[model samples]
Target: MKIAILVEGATERAFKKKLCEFLQSHLGQKMPRLHFITQDGPIPKERKLKKLVETLLDNNGYHAVIALTDVYTGKPDFKDANDAKEKMRIWVDNNPNFYPHTASHDFEAWLLPYWTTIQKLAKHNLSAPSGSGSPETVNHQKPPSYWIKEIFRTGKRGKDYNKVIDGMAILKNNDLMIAINACPELKAFVYRIISLCEEDKIIS
Candidate 1:
């Protein structure tokens, strides 16, 4: 199987790499091929992205095409997350192999549930001000990336967390079950990917 993933940034690319590796291990198959395309920054222009997707599908022999973008960046063509998703759904309509997944707030929101583990690993003394690391609470008031940066800046570490450098390490060490339970959006995306794998008989 061949898969194409269009992502917004380096951190997402790293996370997808880990996710694909996990899927391969779980499926016990090395046959599934993954291709990553970086959008360089947040995807704000829906029409441009649609055109890009069209070109990719026209040129590539991918079994599946998945688009992952953060909802916090605000798309120019849509008023809100629901609107954006609906538009994307329409764009992908009848394209059985295409899937669109949006990360609420930002990619860092997925990591918020595992903040405690990250703090421990980074040896940072920062604590969640709300005393809870739930995604809903943590991602409610601020962009998840900003929230994470605040923790790193205020803590003993003093150094900013580099998503590209540290994100995969943190994800690798943390328990995925905790993330799945804490983040509904993430869980849904994971389930979709797994379902696709099973549907294609990549995993039995």
Candidate 2:
């Protein structure tokens, strides 16, 4: 049950250790090898994406290829999560083995679930975003990454959010299920992986 996840860049790749830890607890021996491939940017556009998926399936030994992109990428490639996924599905032409997932605004949206941990790691006491503290609601305008980066910047540490490092720190030892419950996109991502691995759906 090997799977490949195509993402934007190194920030998501930093998820490797924590993500695996979470998967192992639930899937146990059924946990699959998840390969995360980066685009050095957002998942390739349209035909290029189709081409990449085809290559992974036909040339590489992967069983399935999943693409996760941020709806709030610097450019307005996608309006929102649904729009982003819909576009990818259309672009991929609904290939059965190809799955498209998104972080509502960006990768940092996923990190928002661990605010307490973030404050601890960052040595900051910034409050969570006002609206419901729901990660997904952190909009594209301000975006979760901006809030996180701001917190790190103004905090006692006086540093910026290093997407590559801080993201993994926030996720470490935290329960993935918490974020899954908070973010629908994350739930969908986990659902696809769990379903492919043939495990009982603990997420529901």
Candidate 3:
């Protein structure tokens, strides 16, 4: 099946390379046949993304189109995220067969498959010593525990209230994933997407 992939921002082409690697190794496909569309930056205020997707759907010989947008949970980025989701919903309403997925945060598509693992790795990063004086080392950790607790807000049932739980579930269901600024551990996310596609015969 022909699939169309689109991203909201410009990222190092490494992501596409990784995606291609995934397809070749697992799906027996090449990059030339992949339909890729990328925006220069965050989506526009007027939501031009709708037109872009519509054009791709109208012209491309794709069997399915996956729209991927990064999460902007705050201020301007938040607005962009909400707008993008709304546009996709509208598009889906108009075209029932099209599939669109949005990530709760940037790089979530990459981080999702190994949710439990990523959570542990993030915790380890948080536990590491800050000033080891290694130029190659940069801190990459989840927000403080207090912050997580606050977001989840322990009610009758422990921290299971984490809002991110829903976001992760959404990622797990996607047939295709597009991640921007994904760290190394995120390869599992791509693998998971590939695995699901193969299982459901979405890719041959």
Candidate 4:
């Protein structure tokens, strides 16, 4: 299926890659045109992720547009982000084609607790050492490993905890996981294509 994804910044590169890998593993056949629309709007992040998805989409060509991004909490504890998300919701609702699907970490913290636990590394005496890791590592370096260890100690994945973050949390918590999962434009297109395909199957 051909799909377009718009994300806020490129922090979720690993997550995106995992998603594509999941899609490939599940579909068996290659996916068509997975477009990642970002700020540069030309290249979709440096990693081979762009080329891999592009080639896959070119061959199979499913139609869908997905957007992904965090809650964009602009201020301490993401207060401004909350307001910004509201504005974005209004825009999405008013838009002609794009549909907004989202998730909030606060509620979905159970979904991806890594965000919070990672931040606690400093408190656990696992602070980053000076000039050891790569520059990018330094830039995005999270708290020490102890934090993650602690969180994982509780459980792995939201499923184990009887929680489901599946983009529904966005409706109330202003999350963006849903938008990221299904590109609004691309989703509409995919739904249409699937419908048509089903119709053809029935007639044929």
Question: Using lDDT as the measure, which candidate wins?
Answer: 2
lDDT of 4: 0.34
For lDDT, candidate 1 versus 3, the one ahead is 1
RMSD of 4: 14.0
What tens digits encode model 2's per-residue C-alpha lDDT throughout 1-204?
Answer: 889999999889888777888778778889999998988987898999999998999899899999999888899798788898889888978999999999888888888888899888778898988752678888877988888888898888877889888887888788888888898888888888888897565644
**Residue 110 lDDT in candidate 4:** 20
lDDT by residue for model 1 (1-204), tens: 677878888888768766776676666664367787888896635567666666677787777777777777743454445665677767655366667777776788778777777687567767654624656344435767776777766667657788887788778876676776777677767766666667554322
Q: Residue-wise lDDT of candidate 3 within 164-197, one digit each (tens)?
A: 4533443343333333223322333343345445
Q: State the lDDT at 19 in candidate 3.
A: 61
Give me the runs in candidate 4 sitting further than 4 Å from their true place: 40-63, 75-89, 92-97, 106-204
Q: What's the true lDDT of residue 25 in model 3? A: 63
lDDT score, candidate 4, position 16: 46
Clashing pairs in 1: none
Best of the candidates, TM-score: 2
Clashes of each: 0, 0, 0, 26
Measured over all alpha carbons after superposition, the RMSD of each candidate to the real structure, in angstroms, is 3.1, 1.4, 12.8, 14.0
What's the TM-score of each model vs. the native? 0.83, 0.94, 0.47, 0.37
